[model samples]
Target: MRSPARRAPRDADSLWRWATLSPALLLMAALGLLPVLNLFVLGFFDVRWTDGGSSWSFVGTRHYAALPGDPLFRASILNTTLFALGAVAGQMLLGFALALLCHKATRGRVFWRAVFVLPVLIPGIVIGAMWKLLLNPEFGAIAQVFEMVELEPVDWLGEASTALLAVIMVDIWHWTPFCFLLFLAGLESLPRDVYEAARVDGARGWQELRYITLPLMWPTIVVTFVFRLVLAFKVFDEVYLLTGGGPGTATEVVAFTIYQRFFTEDRAGYGSAMAVAVIFLIFLMLAAAAAARRRVQS
Candidate 1:
């Protein structure tokens, strides 16, 4: 008797699905992957503008090496980290408090929720301009209030010491609403039965929150934290409009530095290198966050 023919494997279905999704995959590759590849390639080249025109020369990792010793670059990195940490910590704390309050409140909850989220809906540039006017030492409302209160008016964006803090405050004001919304959603989605069961076991509100609510909301908190962290690292528009990386290098973030190199100095290749570095740092942060999340989940 002839041997029975072997059955074909089911892998063809997956292949067909991938084929159907090829357009989207190709678009992502072109828009995302291609630019990243070009960026990496350009980072190795030195572009120089001469009297006649411009030229590119292979410079290996020269720009990367130079970055470490560059005071402005170092300051930018430090300031960026500080800004991210301060903004994220402050927003998360304040947001969590607001979320809990709003979730528990019986009266005017909708109004309070709308009030909290209004800042997040505002444009970044507009927010920057508004804050700049409000913080201006000359005729700013804040300065006027300080004068009336017998307190010296602060030049929020005019001093290196206060410029970073000013921007950090603005970021917190704009982003806390986002964290509050996420926390509220997480709280509302939690099963009431779990809390009831805890109460049945003689658990107080604090105990139930500590053991059940926080544990249940851990994933949402992680997601929000990572999202905010990434956005904070790449902050630029507000900083640019608010302080312009002055009164010194105090508010100069990594993104601002990259912009300066790319647009102001016209050092496209060096800016590309900085962009690659930022991308690498982001990947590292994401990896660490993933690892931490897994540890917590396990």
Candidate 2:
């Protein structure tokens, strides 16, 4: 058995650790947990806020029950799913390729890294505004590029067919750099000895990448994939700034849907239900990704 005197120091250290963490825990409860709890509470009721939300009434599961048949909500889900899939896949692939190229280069690595990361340093609102300007129909960036190619000047963000795709493209442009940074970090952390051994055995670039680099970087790939997907699922700020979920709701994602319901339509309860649904979808995605990561590791 350990001495009582020895146990005292360990107990004190544990107390010290919790003491250090208490502030963060309190902050999280106030900022994150309380809002989520309010959303959950509001989800199960009918809340009309003419008198500072004092007009709330218990209408259990009414908003949730109507979710399955809500046309706008369904459209929002479809649009969001499509955007997340397209943007995440594009960003991940482009980012990984760029990371590989940069990692293999011997000169100007810092400059190239900075170039790749520049978009990420910019804010979402600025990116949205920039893209909006670029995609303008007349006398804009895309119009100038179109003139070079002898293509007609077309409104990129004003058409239902192109609006969602345009937003997805903009999202990919801004977030691909984030994925690139993660991939670069993962590539840097890979074991150099294994690559050296593979080279000694006359392994080609493709062979080493296929058999060594990919296998080692699998965890990072999963993490990056999951993170990008989650962030994409929550996309709203840029969409709001650029398109305002317009082109006849073509670009209206789930986040925008909730925003419209709560703030625009004054359906706070329904919006809260949608928020809970978004949380559920995020939880499911996280769970699925965690399971996949475990499978890969095992």
Candidate 3:
């Protein structure tokens, strides 16, 4: 809409902005985008490594074409979904409860906070190993406790029926602390005047929480839910250490399936296809979350 003289400065400014951003743009292309592009190319090939020989031959969507009918992949999808649902819900509810309790405690605040957050500080593999020992059926304390109920011993991670549930429990135990920390932060950062006004108006516990606490904390709740859901979808280390996706692929998550295809089965193209599909699913979830977040903000 502007004349040449006016438009020149604006165009120059735009160019200068892009010039400043060029380094970051290039870095992202190199680090983030290039790998994805490579993955897409790999997904169309018959890639192989056998007898110390490696080769790549163009096959054109064969791997991806087979994904829908693959039973193991289908089972992995179901298991991953169930794990996400169970783990995220358990973590969010339990974490909110812990956070609320921590928020109300006036004494030993630091000690209680530290105690709850310690599990999150530990590495995933380490936590998996720790729980593995604790669930060791024969001599572990958990098994011993079950023995007191005359149940003999329960091989928590070894059974097909219980393997996924066991891993989900471990995930809930490890991640609930993270949710607690965030919820506690959100709770404390809330304005104090809201409560004072509510109290002055004769509002009691349930009413205050229903009108004030829940409404205010809804944003944090959404954020925690999305983050935990994403993490739970990618669960592998604990399942690997505890169940190895076994009693025959019972606890097989998408990530583990990708691993098997890539390494053990040496189906590089198929693995790449699987990875691409999983990445697409994650992309959709993140996009939805972003839209919801913008709506919440608006």
Candidate 4:
């Protein structure tokens, strides 16, 4: 009777499931949640190292207030925005074109695909350093090419005007391959019959692309755009390596600004404030992208 102890009570089953998942939940709380919470707390507090290596107290929103008056911070925000926009636009156009070409190519498709993807496999640091050397005004191959064309050698990393552009070029060279691969995958996964039907309808290449290809590829394009936006917004390594945020904060993206505050100035609390601001901005962007995606899907 009693239905075999009623399966040891359904409450016990729920407890057992909770117990099984506790470790993972705890791990996430420890590694992910705690750090974010700590950063949030630190952002509001004033922490500075002493000669004896001890630290200090709460300055409330002092750092946040100071951000608006900081010229370098303003410049960094502008540079980051420009880099994200330029990189996303350039990569999307080039990637879409490469994807279409690959889709239509009848010979050596695999080889061409491999060639297109080669830049993605290179390490970011190596790409940065390579570009740094290659853009050197004195003996770089690029300088040599300019010389051949009877043009004056350009100081790619020397001046503020050219430094950011140099970083942007390096980023584009490395990341366009990623966008191209994503676009190629999207193109290949589309229904062939649709294209065949379009051909039967006497649609020209441009017409087919505009009407059929782009419409169907919007989701993939959106994904690539969001990813690139996030990455480009957080760009640090190449800018750090190539320009060191010089000539005088011209190429300093937000990440490098935070790094300089945290490591060089040892203002951990201020750095945390900047970092939290960055996180907030990125979250807002991602939320907007998600909303747009949902609208498109609907």
Give per-residue CA lDDT, model 3, range 18-69, as digits (tens). 9999999999889998888888889999987778998989999888999999
- What is the C-alpha lDDT profile of model 4 across 171-242, one tens digit per residue? 888899889999999999999999899999899878988999899999999999999999999898898888
Off by over 4 Å in 2: 1-8, 19-23, 51-53
List clashing residue pairs in candidate 3.
none
What's the CA error at residue 158 for candidate 1, in Å? 1.4
What's the residue-level lDDT of 1 in candidate 2?
Answer: 100
lDDT of 3: 0.91
lDDT tens digits by residue: candidate 2, 215-280: 999989999999999999999998899999988989989999998888899989999999998899
Q: Is candidate 1 or candidate 3 better by TM-score?
A: 1
How badly does each model clash, as a count of residue pairs?
Answer: 0, 0, 0, 0
Candidate 4 to truth, TM: 0.90
> Worst ten-residue run, lDDT, model 4?
1-10
**Error in Å for residue 36 of model 3:** 1.6
TM-score of each: 0.93, 0.93, 0.91, 0.90
What is the per-residue lDDT of model 1 for residues 30-101, given as tens digits with 9 covering 90 to 100? 999899999999999999889989899999999887877889888999999999999999999999999999
| TM-score rank order | 2, 1, 3, 4
